[model samples]
Target: MIYKALGGDGAAATVVTAAGDARPGPAVELHDPLELLVPDTEDDYRLTVDPDTGHLGFTSTTEAPYAILKADPYLGARRKQTIPDPAFVVAHHGGPAILERTASVLGCDHRQLRHSWDSLRSQGNMTSVSVLDVLARTLDDPDGPRPGEEGLMLAIGPGVTVEAARLRRT
Candidate 1:
């Protein structure tokens, strides 16, 4: 799994991170948030990025810059992760609103989350056994957003959009 986060609350930020073992094993009740995930296989889905059209590119092992960019205004460059999950990218920087607003930033829809998961398990692709976690988080000022802070997190990795977190702001 992978995780990323930008320090919010305007305090002197501290950095933290960790990863889960990927060797074939039983699904973990992973200490990780379960939301911040990246695909462990391929062809389960597809990745579309057109730089000429301003689409951002992201890898399963790398932080999704578009996700970082989305929360940068309210938070900043933030990310993290843990072991792998079959479907969904769990994230928790600050709650659900972030997930809700993901379409605005990532230029995709919530369905993209499922699409990502399905993409990872298609034929000719590696088989996905079970799913343990799927969530995301972020920060949004109550008085800041026109609609509201985009809660939860949404990222595009090598597969479909990985939905991470169930965000909130303090």
Candidate 2:
């Protein structure tokens, strides 16, 4: 049950996601696997992503492991800054295939993007990571977009997955 950090607004259940299927996907905020997953303790934390370098990290606003997360996200936007939906990325065919296809579409590193995707799951305990949600929301008109254009791509895997949006260098 991965959650969207809505414009730094608390997780909103309604905002659309670029993510696709979740095995036995649970509704947002629904906790059916509580019996198997450990509960999280309350703590303030911040994580920011640097698309330029593929750096994913976190900082805590409150305590130990947390403070590290809270440490300045010097090189990139702060955790609360919302990366927009993809105005350029395209949806690839399927599986890992999407990685290279999307990178080609957005001009990002395919392998680095793949690592970023895997990092989401390995680093944080996100239930399911969203790799292409931001792009879809920004670029495609879910209802349908211009001809020859596909919405942003989304892929979710076991570990926190790479969830990113495409942006044109302005």
Candidate 3:
């Protein structure tokens, strides 16, 4: 019932071409995209299909949100080694709890996640597209990242998976 209320439908389109290919427009350079599955936490959030009814269902435990903390070591190492302190963060709108947990793991305050929270409040959770929606908002925000500034993208999914990337405004 809780998950159902948070479900949202949305779509987005963006142009992507090689740096050398030459497209005349604004672009955000995305690099060093990392993805990981939190060990022993796959059941924290599950999507199952009923064999008889042929219906898809989503289930999550109370521990689902905190599972993202398990990825902190890797994320922290990346930040220390390569990624710069981002001027902004674009995170998926999983929910209030997930957003709070993500902020804790990233060592950022909730105010830094304003775009994500705005998206969640306005559109609920758009699942795979939630981060995209937040990114769109961040790009459109008047006070958003400026050219040459660095940013980070983070998202969580079933299997307690973590998807992250370093972004640069170009």
Per-candidate TM equals 0.23, 0.20, 0.88
Better of 1 and 3 by TM-score: 3
Off by over 4 Å in 2: 1-94, 111-115, 119-129, 132-170
Model 1, residue 39: what's the lDDT?
39
Model 2 superposed RMSD (Cα): 16.8
lDDT of 1 by residue, 97-169 (tens): 4334443444445554443343333311111211112221111112321222233333433343343443322
- lDDT by residue for model 2 over 36-82, one digit each (tens)? 11113123333456689875544333232222122223102421243
Candidate 3: C-alpha RMSD to true structure equals 2.0
lDDT of 3 by residue, 38-128 (tens): 7888889977778999866679887887877878887888865656567889999688988988888777777779999999999888887
Candidate 1 wrongly placed segments (more than 4 Å): 1-41, 44-142, 145-150
Order of the predicted models by TM-score, top scorer first: 3, 1, 2
lDDT of each: 0.31, 0.31, 0.82
Lowest-sum lDDT 10-residue window in model 3: 1-10
Estimate the overall C-alpha local distance difference test score of candidate 1: 0.31
List per-candidate RMSD values in Å.
17.6, 16.8, 2.0
